[model samples]
Target: MTDQAIIKTGGKQYRVAVGDKLRIEKLTADVGANVDFAEVLFVGAGADARIGTPLVEGAKVNAVVRSHGRGKKLIVYKFRRRKNYRRKNGHRQPYTEVEITGISA
Candidate 1:
């Protein structure tokens, strides 16, 4: 009966609530596809909260994939003083945008 929950995906954890939109690690799901996050760590808040030892059993959060995109590029610069060793690189992490539809706990 809670409105908020914590979910784990792609080695990361996110706090979400119904109708929330989030960008997370890339998934294979296409746009408008349904995705379920079963690794719920906690649900609810205050006195009504439920905390799982590792993951809550029978708890899940449903979402719909809205889009797929990459995050802003990050500059990775490596340099060594007096060693003439310098490297510059850029990275853009792929992510999936999803909207939380419902949470069952």
Candidate 2:
């Protein structure tokens, strides 16, 4: 069995394996650029598993930035009953799509 790792990025943690694709907080890399994640919290599984005290030394997850885009828009409405006050807002969070290529620990 291959190793799976939990990597932290953009203030969030994600469990990943090779070839897995996910949308995460927008990164500064250009499309098709290689990115390396060094904050690996956990790696492997079963008897070979290793856990990090904050982070596992010499562990890393490699990926390629696929695309950057914003998510679906969300509408937020606020109103004050009987006060004739209302506000409506729309939001779309930006994110980057990435494909995990390799992991080393």
Candidates' RMSD to native: 1.4, 0.8
lDDT of each: 0.95, 0.97
> For this target, which candidate reaches the highest TM-score against the unseen true structure?
2
Q: Estimate, for each residue in 18-83, the C-alpha lDDT of model 2 and write its tens digit.
A: 999999999999999999999999999789999999999999999999999999999999999999
lDDT of 1 by residue, 31-103 (tens): 9999999999998888988899998889999999999999999999999999999999999999999999999
CA lDDT, candidate 1, residue 15: 97
TM-score of each: 0.94, 0.96
lDDT for residue 10 in candidate 2, whole number 0-100:
92
- What TM-score would candidate 1 get against the native? 0.94
Off by over 4 Å in 2: none
**Model 1 clash pairs?**
none
